[model samples]
Target: MDARQKQLCIGEGFHNIDYRILKSIVDCIYEAVCVIDENGIVIVWNKGAEKLYNIAYKDIIGENIEDIFPDAIVNNVRKTGVSVENKYHSPRENSYILANSMPLYIEKVFKGAVSTDRDFAELIKLYFELENANSKLIFLENEVKKISGVFGNIIGKSPNIVKKIDMARQIAPTHASVMITGESGTGKEVFARGIHELSGRKGLFVPVNCSAIPSELFESEFFGYCAGAFTGANKKGKMGIFELADEGTIFLDEIGDMPLHMQAKLLRVLQEREIVRLGGEKNIKLDLRVLAATNKCLQEMVRESKFREDLYYRLNVVEINLPSLRERKEDIPIFIDYFIKEFSTRNSKKIIGTQRDVLNILNEYKWPGNIRELMNVIEHIIVTNKNGMIQKNSIPEYILSQAKKSESFKEYPLDLTKAIKKLETENIKKALKISKNNKSKAAKLLNIPRGTLYHKIDEYKIKCPK
Candidate 1:
């Protein structure tokens, strides 16, 4: 047989063979592949190569690889008779690819080289998807830790609540100041304590309600007074909260209620990391983490000039916004079960559960006071019922009334499309607000790609207020 016939010949197992059939199999491969002779001339170019490089096999065959795909490894391997493995190369603009090239030797004589390429962009896209999935899993794990008694034994499994718990867990180990924002009964203090506990701080966790501390006494309460500092001051002298919180965490609840003058002093303390007692002359340095919580809108307060912008920015380095009980209604049942078991165990009652009607009523009513209100109602039931399951008539009068009103009230048509759009818009706005106008974080919060978020923003014409 001639040399051409020998190259086309199949092994002894095959009786009849066609070169076209072999070429067809090679062309069907997904990875770009190429073969070159010892002189660096293209001898075989598969269909994958044509699609990847946007050049036909007929155009590249018999031509020098250097003229077209100049960076092809086939040329290098042909020259040195050495194989190149897993090399990254970009043959065209925006075309990133990984390739493997090996020299072909027959009977100890150099012949040519074969190279295959895989699209790098596709691999990168898949990697990003995997990372996003891992982030979600971490969020769920952190939420599970919270309700299972790892941190303050929190209870709730709604997506928004879980996301906030996850964020707190991520930032707890750091010394960065955190701001917790939510309505009055949303358990901001609980979230703050959770952060402090997970922070692994050695010092004690001291909590102070800014609204309760009189403006005139703010300085004395925050910083301390020395002996004989004032007429009514303690004779032995008092250490300020900042001092008491050394090497620990001091939770500043209702921070937005701090007076303007006190805000200035607080900003100074944050910047200098030191404080002077009410009557002392010497400055006391502090090493502690500050976790602030508020039921009011700090940004609005900043704009209204009620809160100092500098102080707000300082304490707002890391913010965890808790969702209200009404917003995360899915967690109502969980909370109901948790609070029942808690109150029952504590009160020495054998209350097993609540009736279905009672749960429906509780879930339907908007919890204006959030979890605090929910706990109070549960305790009321446990105390009043004392035994057996809680019934509809046993619930609070206000909750039953609210549930009746909610059921009777009517809104626009319950079209699924419109409802979905409204929900989407509300979620987007919430994410943007929580992220402080950071589009990237908002996208993560919404569990969508950044590009998709941008598209939704445009479609909904959502305004980001920061």
Candidate 2:
């Protein structure tokens, strides 16, 4: 060879090297490399390709490419003489890899195709982990803010409420299942969220209301499903609530509402620490804490055959019973003051504190709906009375009628104008009911001018039921 030709051959080392040396060099490449002849026969199958597809080169070389591999990109390149880059899936390896394929030509004559593949499974796993971590961080921040000062979103300082919070905090760090029992609207979710924050888990908090999910979809929603697992299934499949809640807290609100059949399934998951999808054979392991809440008496339900006995015990590792609003009446004024400020800022209102008469009446009322009802009442008062101090007349009619005031009118001063307005409102409502809500007829029934009736209706903001 001439000096220039020898330099070229040496520069391209494989051109003059032994076949074994060239094969070793190809095997050293990290990415999968494969070359096919013009007759669609496999000529080169590197070590990376064997590792990626789990197929040995000995079995693949000299074999028809179509018989050894089902990848369509190689055939497409040979047919169209075009290069293509895409994500490819290998069913044998159950893996996905980035693949690039280009037509190979010898002196402008089409020969075959060469392809390279890069596996991205590890990168995809890391991406999901980072996303899950970010979600957990956001949730923890919010939970910290909610219970930051004294009791997070729970707005009570009474002994009953404080004791419950202390118990929640004590059990927060453990992986024990917590059962929060209370009447509806007793801030059960607040305690659940607070406990999750304190637990310091590195996964997002997932809350599922047992009563909200349809019975037929319960299994699919909780355990997930594989692609083509059932008719109408998503082609890519879906992750279940438990899988999504891995390394986090799953707050199952109203656990008593879970049907008997599903309760058995839940019991198995808790016991096994794993779940098999609705239409899948694989069992997915779980690392999660379950927090359940219910207004119903689970023990009683168990006795009555309404709830599973074993599942109840599994979920009742720790129990926190929230006191009703009436049981902790001392916290009423505190909650009222806090809510007044909260709703005032939210609604851009300048209204002030509740009057003594209103506070006394509110404290005496039996709040069947608990803290949630109290918040609603406060919101209503702030929205209805935006100009001055909140008055007793702003209270809902049902509450005012049911509430037992401790001090009589003689003991506590009353607003005469408000009482008169209330009386007038009652009369106008009765007249409208009698007249079937015909404004002119109602005015005649009440012996008032139609204009006066309109003014009174606007003044009271009365909404007549149709």
Candidate 3:
């Protein structure tokens, strides 16, 4: 049956196979393929090759391939038996191409050459888009590097601060969980961020203000939860802080205040190098560098049974204690100038230097609030004294009040209750003097409720000295 069918087809001489089918296949391929002989004679050129080179295969065959395109530079490929790739055109207009050329080899001998090319017009457009995105990404990276206080962020001339910065830089390359310790106003978080910035991690920083979050939510907040994990959980699920900080740094601020139970969970995460989402079964591998900062001493908390002793040691691989502003007053002028300029530009104000006397007062007065307070003071000065150079007079009443705060109240024949009342009055008067009687801001600085401060003022009959 097969022989008869084949004989009938041969007799009719109608195979019906079309060459267009072959050419159609070549035209559809995105990459242009070209084949040439030893003398650089174009033997096989696909439609894609023709369209790409802007010359038809019919026009190129039997012609010297090198002389035909000129830009093809086929002579070099023939002479050297080497292929060229991604070579740019010397005089290009709207387009470019990525060429992959290979000298055709058969039985260990070079026969001719074959090439494939991809149009760069679309690729160049993509490259420009990529370049724009990369430029913006780099700018953002630079900005983040600055804010994170890496090499570029730690700005200060004071030897003490510089020494600390140098130490931080020395330790930045290691994969260590650094514990930064300092008073509430010291720049502990800055050091933590600086460590992360220096580590070259591209992940987002996840800072957990341990004191700010409610204890019940710690596990869910740090390790996240699967969908339907909790009664009111998000349907699609959530990515926890630790997951977000993967391959990056997690800054646990106020670590001393972290709850004992949460501290235990944190210890497990540190030890296991992984975390299981709350109310979920799977364990997520965590690749994170933990940087913790606290005003309260962990050793003290551990002794008091408030902090887990095990966690303390785990987090304290390296410790960087930020110096209080009082200890680093020499850095104050540097800080002051930096802050004033920043706020001036942000607030768009013309305010500049405080009087020399005021600067001296700033230097002398103990900045209990540290860097944060200094920055706020600069902002306040700019807001309040907007038009002119700041003066000693423009300095807030608080700076001046410290000197007068110790003065005793003038009274005679002091009764036990009256004497106590007089002392209270004197203290309140001093606070008013220092705060310039800005009760609200004064209350903030004093770390007390505004209502409580007002009650005390009423009870003591405190007034600003005229």
Candidate 4:
């Protein structure tokens, strides 16, 4: 064969093989794949890209990518010789995509750029669907609790909790102001809600987070405001929390956080049962009940002049203190069972129960965050649990470490006399070890007389290292 014929044959063979490989690999990918030349001209547009952009390869292959898709990531990659990974892009309206683009280099020179993109519309849709489902589940849970009773949400059968429940029921029907005090996350809000439900009021229950309202907006937020009251104010005016809770109950959470001036205003409103809207002269009479909760010592605040004594006296008509989890440890198992069922149903898990060991560890834990922390731990366990039961390893590592520390502490005596003796014994042994069994040096190290040290060693019967 002649030289020209041989060269033509080789060129045809190479073109056929390259075309086959490109069609099989790049064109078959599910994610959109596009390649551009050195001048931002489209060289390869896969079927995925065609489907995503709604433009065919024949129509776009030879076109400059800038004209077709001005903000294409491949164009930036070619111009800057820089790569972009997992970047958010919206090529068209309502089209969300996550794209990875890289500059293609051949022999240390920039050749072009290639990009792969995955549509995120489906993922976003699924996320919204999950959130909707969770909302429905929570609504159903609250409805179920309501059906049970007014105090159904507060889960405890301990003496303290039961006593508090009875007291709450006795006072719920009255119009007296109640002060619910407890440590944070000890179901103070739940108790307040129960009181409202039992009150048989015909108005809405408006919960006001005293700490969250800005000081500047306190008056307007607690009372109604007239239209055009201030710049950026709602044109139709707004009803403050107290006004909204007319003829019902207003739950003031974190009441201690109310500023001194606001406290005076609140006291006046409560005493008069009337509120005059901001920028208006007419006093609006209200029949709402007030229930305030705090995780602070209002008595101490009164002594320090941080809180108003008159307001304290008015709000504390009846004080009901909720017991902390540590104070009511016997109720831990009940809370665990309740939370397990709730979380299991939410997560679509069939978790029958936790292992006895897991329960033991959880019960031993001093839940500083109280019921809130326990609820979170149960949710975590339900989410991570694979089997039908919650195993020891499924518990959070932090809880396990804390439980271990508690167990170690439990080995020591709690009695004052015995604790002191035990601590003395351990220190004596440590001193002896540090002094290499020399009694005189050990006594000096312990800062105790040698005679006393000898008496301690004999009393405690501590063995010395030979």
Regions of model 3 farther than 4 Å from truth: 1-148, 403-466
User: On residues 1-466, what C-alpha lDDT tens digit does candidate 4 reach at each position?
Assistant: 3445433433432334465467578877999998876778676788998888888877776667899788888899999988999999987677789899998875676768999998888666776578657756885977788644489888888999999999999999999999999999899988888999998998877788899989998999989798988888889998888889998899999999999999999999988999998888889999999999999999999999999999999999999999999999999999998888777767766665668999999998889999999999999999998877789998899999998888878878889899889889888888989999999999999998999999999999999966
> lDDT score, residue 168, model 1?
89
What's model 4's TM-score?
0.61
Q: Whole-model Cα lDDT per candidate?
A: 0.82, 0.82, 0.75, 0.86
Clashing pairs in 4: none
Give candidate 4's whole-model lDDT: 0.86
Task: Name the weakest run of 10 consecutive residues (lDDT summed) in model 4.
Answer: 6-15
The list of candidate 2 runs beyond 4 A from truth reads 1-144, 147-151, 404-466
Where is model 1 more than 4 Å wrong at Cα? 1-152, 410-466
TM-score of 1: 0.56
Query: lDDT tens digits, residues 1-466, model 2?
Result: 3445433433332243475676788899988898776667666679998998888877776666787556556766777888988756563456777778998876677768888887778556776567556655655664578754234677777899989999988989888999999999998888998899899898878989999999999999999999998899999899999999999999999999998999999999898999998778988999999999999999999999999889999999999999998889999889888777666655656664668989888888878988899999999998888556888899999888776443334433378888778777888898888888888988998899999999999989977646
lDDT preference between candidates 1 and 4, better one: 4
Task: Provide the TM-score for each candidate, comma-separated.
Answer: 0.56, 0.56, 0.56, 0.61
1-466: candidate 3 lDDT, tens digit per residue: 2445433432332134353464567677878777666667665568787777677766665566667666664456767877787765531355467777777765666667777777878676776567556655665665776775665756567777788888888888788888888888787777777778788877767778989989898888888889999799999899899999998889999998888888888998899999888778888897888999899878888898888888999999988888888887788888888777666555546563568877877787788888888888878887777456988766788877863453223352358887777666766677667888888877876677889888988776666565
As a whole number from 0 to 100, the lDDT of residue 356 in candidate 2 is: 90
1 versus 3: better lDDT goes to = 1
